[model samples]
Target: MPATSSTTEFSRTGNGSSSASTKDIEVQLQQLREDISALAKTVAAVGNEKATEVKGKAKRAAADATDASYQMVEAAKSQAVSLERDLERQIRANPIQSVAIAAGAGFLFALLSRR
Candidate 1:
């Protein structure tokens, strides 16, 4: 009878230890979930910050490109006007020579077309 009682006591102690271990595991799992949730939030915040930075950079780059394009167009217009003035001066200085050159070019073109 004594031995049976001791065996029963041992069994009860084992059951208690098992229950305690299971409860500890549950608590650890819950803590892990909380930690993971915090980490996810941090990651999302960082991503948002980077996205905003990238958007600003893109906007600035686009503005710079637009300004550069406008400058190029203005420069081209200025060059064209300067060239036109130079051409007009040449034509005024030598109208006869220009007419002769055009006639010669037309004759050459006619000859080439015949060939």
Candidate 2:
């Protein structure tokens, strides 16, 4: 009787090494390519999400600035109206005194204009 040796179909060079199979190497390479593609998609998704978040923050800031500006303008207009009303009331209460003040101001303007 002769002794027998066991070998697998993928074990070439008679070394029982399945790692030498071209089919196995190609399969691993294909899996690596797929993993890289998935990683790229994930990175792109994260980038897009960050961009959207920043855009939203910028829009909110702009809206807040506009609201503040409108409030300030309204306040200035209210102050101007209040001052005008006070002046009108003063003129009405002392008509003769207002006339004297106006005459004095006119004389000063005339003197200054002569220069």
Candidate 3:
């Protein structure tokens, strides 16, 4: 008896399924790079917007401080004017008393000069 080896036909076509092609991997890598670039752009834009907002707020705060300073100055001027007017009114209403007070001061000065 002679032993013989036999070959079996598995398929007629050579087409087979694979995980992914090289071109598909390249496409996926390109998409990931694009997504990263887009995310970086978004973060930069948000940072710039926040900086602008802070700058505006600082400007407004400076303006408010300036306004408050002006208001305080105006109030001080008004108080000084009121004081001047009151002194003038007092002098006018008590002319005789004012003269008597001046005479007494003068007499005191003369006595001090003698000393």
Q: Order of candidates by lDDT, top first? A: 1, 2, 3
Score residue 70 of candidate 1 by CA lDDT: 100
Give lDDT tens digits, candidate 2, residues 1-115: 1222334432444443445566678899999999999999999999999999999999999999999999999999999999999999999999999999999999999999999
Decide which is better by TM-score, 2 or 3: 2
**How far does residue 49 in candidate 2 sit from its true spot (Å)?**
1.3
Give all TM-scores, in the order shown.
0.83, 0.59, 0.51
lDDT string for model 3 (1-115, tens) is 1222221121212122223455677899999999999999999999999999999999999999999999999999999999999978988999999789889999999999999
lDDT of 1 at 115: 86
The reply for model 3, stretches above 4 Å from the true place, is 1-29, 91-115
Q: Give residue 94's lDDT in candidate 1 (0 to 100).
A: 100
lDDT, candidates in the order shown = 0.98, 0.88, 0.84
Pick by lDDT: 1 or 2, better one: 1
Task: Quote the positional error of residue 44 for candidate 3 in Å.
Answer: 1.0
* Quality of model 3 by C-alpha lDDT: 0.84
RMSD of 3: 9.2
